[model samples]
Target: MSVKRHAFVTEENSISCSQTEQTTVQKTETGSKFTCQQCGRSFAAKGNLKVHMRVHTGERPYSCAQCGTSFTRKGSLNAHMRTHPGESPYICKLCEKSFSRKESLKAHMRRHAGVKPFTCVQCGNNFTRKESLKYHMRIHTREKRFKCRQCGTSFSDKNHLKDHVMTHAGETPFMCDHCGKTCSNKANLEIHRRIHTGEKPFTCPQCGKSFTAKGNLQTHIRIHTGEKPYTCARCEKSFTYQRDLKRHDSDPFNCALCNKNFLLPTHLRIHLRRHAYARPYFCSLCGKSFRWLGSLKWHQKVCICAKTLLPEF
Candidate 1:
């Protein structure tokens, strides 16, 4: 009886066979006839191998017509199409939260189950999803693959780069209904809406203080934890906030008339307005002027003179 041997090329760019007992040959077992030339991954069918080759080639044949998002597989593009029509077939029983895909619902279930399968070997941090672990690994690797063409700024996440790109174009699609204020992104607009609604969802357990945003809550927690992550390079002084460290490194903005020093340029500009007696803000009802907009708003609230004046058309 004669035995047939399978051969494949490896990372070293050398051809090796199963007779030589190479690791590449081990993967070619279980009757996987079709193999990927670039990654040495074996597949059962020729069509499967051809589809797998798209990973190395970065070829996304399946594209979304609604959002222009490209996917390697047809199934992935089909799953993405549900998002456009707000079709969420998968729903969590615990929280009643809906997801477009089954895999997303499965990952969300892990949070309820307290199951973290993916873990970083370097930091020992566990994540429920594989994609989350992949993004977290970039912190240790310092690999920022996504770069902005407009400002040359690099981001670890593609979504963050997408948000940063909008700043360059001055795109403020998300607007607040209360104050007519506009925000660059939907998340920022949601946070800005909390100010009008007086909603503080993130609460500090230690101090019992509440914050509108998660980032602000995290910063508030550092006050109790004494975690000063930002440090000044010049004086080696640490601060809880990056803005404080920047102020420590920067020269003080001095007032020419009073010789007073301010940490920020905006503070100095406001102080200069005091020296110049500049009252830019004025009340339309009473025709009363004030140095600051806050003062003008406060005076308008208590100003009974508006009652005596006739209404303007």
Candidate 2:
């Protein structure tokens, strides 16, 4: 008989994804005393067997107070709580970067170590994390396990299915403080906040330039590597960024702040800056200020008063 003793470790300030961690079970010489009714798995302790039954019953007893999201384990709830305030306690030793969860830090460590532990047997694809490998396996298996009860739509992951169902529900749970705009997910809200905060954390490896999102950094990295990852589904045309792909298809990216449309999200982000009072460029001769770099460059060439600033450049 195996007696699994549950040990709960809580982070001091931040929320972690790991919840209700169970340590190595203490195996006894005595025969199995506790047996799970659903799976017929025997355990030494009745409490261990009871918690294990949640797998069969699909019961998430613990829930977040702020988001009203439920979790099967207490540790998951602990981790989910950190997302609300954006507190990340888990930090990487090499780069000293803090992550919202320990698992995320562990995954980030792979990038520094160049570790590819998980491999796909079917396609020889390698991934840093096990969950990513499992996600990749769906490509080979064509597994759409997360089925939507409302519609006939299915997804490879639970979160994807959850997001798909929200489209039908039309519920915008996450909202922006600055623009009062709303989104379906918390991640989107975080990305939107970067516009107001002007926080660009993701930096280019080749260049010292930074961006608000990792996706933007990836697109910028493609510029150095000459990697065109985005492809048009209609004509099979490739693009370095998704915004370029949309632009090639004549799709306009619209700004919510002003009813004006642009070709890229970067353009929309820049367009949003017009709504805010941000003057980073200055003309030495006229003491004139501009919000954008292009405007200042044009002023240097066209404006006679901007002649003195050319020496600084």
C-alpha RMSD for every candidate: 16.7, 20.0
TM-score of candidate 1 on Cα atoms, chains taken together: 0.44
Q: Total clashing residue pairs per candidate? A: 0, 4
lDDT (0 to 1) per candidate: 0.74, 0.70
* Per-residue lDDT over 173-233 for candidate 2, one digit per residue giving the tens place of the 0 to 100 score: 6789899998767787898899999999998878899999886786577789775655556
The TM-scores of all predictions, comma-separated, are: 0.44, 0.42
Candidate 2 regions exceeding 4 Å error are 1-76, 81-105, 118-126, 133-157, 226-313
Q: lDDT at 308 for candidate 1?
A: 64
Q: For model 1, where is the 10-residue window of minimal lDDT?
A: 1-10
- The candidate that achieves the highest lDDT relative to the unseen native structure: 1
Candidate 2 vs. true structure, TM-score: 0.42
